[model samples]
Target chain A: MIRRGLLFVIIVAALALAPPATAERLIVSLSTHRVLINSNFTGTELVLFGAIELADPDILDRRGYDVVVTVRGPQRNFITRRKAQVLGIWINAESREFVEVPAYLAVSSNRPFAEIAETEFLRRSRIGIDYNILTQRIGTDIADVVPQDPFRVGFVRVMRAEGMFSETPNGVTFLSSTHFRTTVPIPGSAPTGTYEVETLLIANGALVTRETTAVEVVKQGFEALVAQAARDQRLAYGLLTALLALLTGLFASLVFRRD
Target chain B: MRRLERRRPFGPERAHVSIYLPIAELPVNLFVILGLGIAVGFISGMFGVGGGFLMTPLLILTGVPPAVAVASVPSNMAANSMSGTISYWRKRLVDIALGLVLLSGGVVGTAAGVWVFGVLRRAGQLDLAVSLSYVVLLGIVGSLMLTESVRAILRAQRGEPPVVRRPGTHAWFHGLPLKLRFRQSRIYVSAMPVTAIGFAVGFLGALIGVGGGFMLIPALIYLMRVPTTVAIGTSLLLVLVTNLIATVLHAVENRTVDAVLAFTLMIGGVVGAQFGARAGQAMRAEQLRLLLALLVLAVGVRVGVDLITRPADPFSVVATETFQ
Candidate 1:
């Protein structure tokens, strides 16, 4: 009995002193392609699809986090040239947290090619390409990168693609790729740690390859502690109130009658 | 000590007032409630029906608690029925004895209905039952009315007489004992049928949140063979009494009635009742019955369809928790 008690004490001490294990990371692949064009090519547009996967085994243990993707490229030229154009930007994933299971990326487009591009190009092509090209290309390349910071994990890349060439007064005829990249900063309130990161190369609106690296985010002061409490509290209250009011009103109406 | 005093914002003395006026102090959604009242009142007056059947369902659909919807409907119906009943009485059309007898049964039926409502609600079957009943009853009634009305119109256009003769009198009614004299109806009939009808109307009114005017008027005219003029007046009188009782019951039991909501609906109903009474004067008895029957059938079908297609969602959100 004495030996067992001593062993328990040692185990508790070790657990208290040891650093918390890092949460598993998730990698999402997003892809976009432009296939249709109208005369003037200015209206020609691209579509995007995204997919998500667990990067580390431990990712399944951690709470899910939202994913946001922004694709930025020359908007004006693409619209006028009847060329595949990346307009303002596309955020395939909005505010959604997912577990370790694979999730299909929401696929969408700005507008139909016929509607946006010049009428002539639209008449030429009837077939539309799959929207998942970009997600597949980038997601596959970045799957290996582990997040060094348990709280922070993300990647961005610039991709260029060229294909069946066509020209217009506004731009060159060669099907060209649009490139952009972003690095998201984990706020101080985020979990303290380092995270694995990955880089993706995309061509013809598809993720072609990837590069992996480590990202570090150091812990900071009191502000982080306060910020986290505020966020969690606010989310909890908002969801609770809206759901409650809607339900109570419905049930009460059904159950009681004056007569 | 000062800090402790500051922390306790409300003193113990203030607690009772807070409980009594909990909802009273809260901001009311007056516009939405008033709009619903006006629409329901207009329909009720124009159609010469209490409109509770439609109003109660409409209130629920718009997110009012079911208890509140049921509780408030009778009060609203009372206001409208009062105005209409008074006008009919002035015109010397009311059959007071027949109306009183029906009302007696209606009151008892209403009490029983309310009790059953409680039971079904606890068992979680109320919504499905109500919806199914609405659809089935309305579909049958509406089709029959529509068919009868169309036939009447066609016959009239072809220069046929308005009244159709029956071969036999109401012999079964004569056999019933405990006869009562209804001066306005100018007949002596057993009090049993009148009381039974009253009870049925009362119970249905409480369960379905209606005044039972539509049902009562038809029963008086067809089942009792009362004249059309007396039937209308008697039905309206019965509606007034039954609705008054329902309103009182709701107030005492559930405390669900929103006085402000009831007031708003009453205003609309009052105005609509005047116009409705005027229009009713011009319509033939058969025409009016046909129209009312069609309305009932329509409402019934709607309720029934809702039950069959998608029973009420059992898991509903309530008071910061989800309950089934």
Candidate 2:
């Protein structure tokens, strides 16, 4: 038993040393992990803080640190339309469908995202709002999705107008050399789901390490019951709504009757 | 301690209660929804219309998703029509024989329309089809009503004697086969035509977010020669039933009906309908008809303009909800 335990510890040590870059060097957490969306809920803010796990003497010389924090809500598919003037009337001429795009997305970085990482890296990791959509699930193949289209642009524009997708440069502030913080405002229209808070640590214009944590947005109290009933017991809920209307009408007629 | 308090993860609490809508996936001020309901209810009561066409657009403008708005309006409509039908029934103006026949057809048509609605929705053709149909139906009906009401006002000014007709007789649609006598309507006509009319109205009403009252009343008076009082009551009864079907379909099939949203609206609607009925009594029938015609035309024009003109954002996004 002792020999086996020693071998397990040695294996863990070997794995830990094999790729220091693959291990999460930054510790990230949110002040509030669960957001209860009650009837009184309007909007709320998430305070995310993180710190470097390891201290290095040449941290300043190692091309400094860049933090990119993103809070992504549930995934959903969206069909976007692009209008073109036909016979002097603009209609939905061309359309594209995108799948697996976060219903809500917010990004905050220590500096401009362009300054932190190349466009290709940001696009691959979906680090920014511009590249965080999967288009062409319908009416076109996945291979044709690249080279973003006007429909994709429209989706971002609409979400931004609704305050669902947002980016604020200089949103992250470093309290100290190794500690960083950000504030992501949860909009009133944010869908109830498990939101992912991701903190990317970049050095020398490359991603060095990252950390992620989950924050659940859920309906509570009466709100929870109603939402659940509408989704789970839909047929019964519908019948009840109809019955309530019939009863209200019958009750009102008797109460207000006059001869 | 002060610093600790300041570092709290969430912000200070809001004083007003904001209702969280499940299907719409948004939180809005409680009073705002109630007030919207009252406004639409007043319009419905004043004009003798279902008001879904007006209410659905207003809800969409207020940031409720189109699908949710289309689904939830029928709930309030059911309540309004039920109450209206009750008053008419008490007055002994309802023709149960005629109402029941039309309603049988309405039930079948609404069921089929909902199935078509589901199919069209999955194919992403619902919005375009609905918009096109609204422009066509509202434009044609509004213009025809406007002209007819205008002529009535003119004929009245000229002091022309009112047209009189004997009851228990049929004029239009009398030649068709499958003839049946509607004792209350005092007509002998084919069941095929009546059922066809009922089917068309119910199908269109479900496809669009309407209760079919505005269109159905006129058809009953002009085409079927139903007495105005009886037509009103019958129309309300039909509206109540069809609206229920549409609401249930939207709730169960689409999962877009938000109960909380509908409840808040109902609170305002039931009360506002009473006030509207009283106010409507103060106005002349001619004035009311003219006003309603103008309103209908205006709505048609607004929708038509959206189709004809260039949209600000040429592209629109409809998020297909993934339950997971």
Candidate 3:
């Protein structure tokens, strides 16, 4: 009777932490284009625009879930727009090749698609600079870019969704979704940095989510760095050599003293 | 965390871990150190040599730094030498005057040797020179000693008395001006040879980081024609004085002495010496010579092989501008 009671308690705890039976599906997509502006603009400017759709539309504004878009390069920042109108541009403190812009929308609204699109929807975010005047900006050169084969940009969706398996009696497995797309920049003699693509999700023509991802640029090869360090610390090498010599002598003295 | 709780305080963490302690806390490892001291001490008592040639290397192998190993050698020798010399002195075996003269010459030679050492260090050639010299000198000496001892052994086995013939080289000593009498050696010789030998041994001792006892004992016995017993006693006396001086010099210049390590070895040496002395009493002089010769030869061959093999890297390379 006591053993049965203990087993029942364990089973009850496991069932309480188990994930919900239904899973929410999310879809994400990205697009890219070069906006050719006047010759006076010396840099590349990036703008991220995208849409997201959720099958279970009511779960959009869950407290623990977030959607973010990022743009990255050697020196890049973010500019956001709300209601199809420009909001403000902010200096990107964490400027690498990628910068992230994030947006969140609550799920409780029940409105028509046309009404949602007309009601001051978010639009027109710019990453690097204004698209109309691009050439005057100090951007990366064409020849000095890192290979894009290993570089990547992507989005990940983390949900509070959970699940249970019999083998893991005390643990619950959570559900997550990810989507990514990246393009390699042409290598040229330009200042090196990260370049990226960013996107926002639109559900029923209303802004619902955003995400950021990147491609990297680098300068020197790996082996070159090691060779440079060796050249710089020659004295340390010499000292190591001398210590070895002394060790050899001592070993010799020990072995051959009885000649 | 559970394993950490099982560790005991003041226990051997590893076979050769270095332990640091204030002087007051030294007694923890004193027993093992005392044992090493006794072993080397007994060797000193028996052979009347400082045993520094062996001690310095052993200390280094036991994880003491080279500079500290070299510097601590003299102090260790002094302790062993003092104990051995006292016993010999009690037997009325030491020649005080002869030992004093050798000590005086050793002091002067050591100064010169230290200067040469400094110059070689600056030139970045000291490591190579010292190692090569150790191999050359010890190999030759050890081989000669071994051969002589072997011959003596063979003669004894054949039940023949060993022959001793005086070398016909008295002409070399005739012209030297200052003549001195050494009652123990029973010779009236010019001070030049004694002084020269002292200087040579002193230089070698400094360079090799030994107490010069091995060199001094052999030179006294074979060249000066001192009796074996007298040579042993006088050698110990000279070593005691010379090593004391060297220890002081090393302390002043390099501050390389590690008192803890020295004390540990000395502890072992002292206990070992008592047993070694007892063992020595049972052995014949020929047997002792044979053993010493074999030991030295083994050391020499080891050193020589290293020197002849591929060139080795140096321990330190301080950059300096060369005019040329």
Best candidate (score: DockQ): 2
> How well does candidate 3 score on lDDT at residue B188?
68
Tens-digit per-residue lDDT, B90-192, candidate 1: 6778988888888778889988877776675544445545554566555665676677777877888898886533325776767899899988887678999
lDDT of 2 at B52: 78
* Per-residue lDDT of candidate 2, residues A111-165 (tens digit): 9999888998998777777766654575445522443566666677877866778
lDDT tens readout by residue for model 3, A1-259:
9999999998888876663333333343333343222111122323232333445555555423323333333332211111111122111111112222111111111222233344234224321111111111114532212212111110001100000000111111113323322222221211233544444334455444554555443324322232232234333422332233233323322432322
DockQ of each: 0.01, 0.44, 0.01
Candidate 2: clashing pairs of residues: B168-B186
The alpha-carbon lDDT assigned to residue B103 of candidate 2 equals: 83
**Backbone clash numbers for all candidates listed:** 58, 1, 86
- In angstroms, how far off is A162's CA in candidate 3? 50
Best by TM-score: 2
Chain A accuracy as TM-score for every candidate: 0.19, 0.81, 0.26
Off by over 4 Å in 1: A1-259, B1-32, B164-168, B282-285, B310-314, B317-324
Of models 2 and 3, which has the larger TM-score? 2
Q: At residue B248, give the lDDT of candidate 2.
A: 87
Native-to-model Cα distance after best TM-score fit, residue B245 in candidate 2, in Å: 1.9
Q: Is candidate 1 or candidate 2 better by lDDT?
A: 2
Worst 10 residues of 3 chain B by lDDT: B1-10
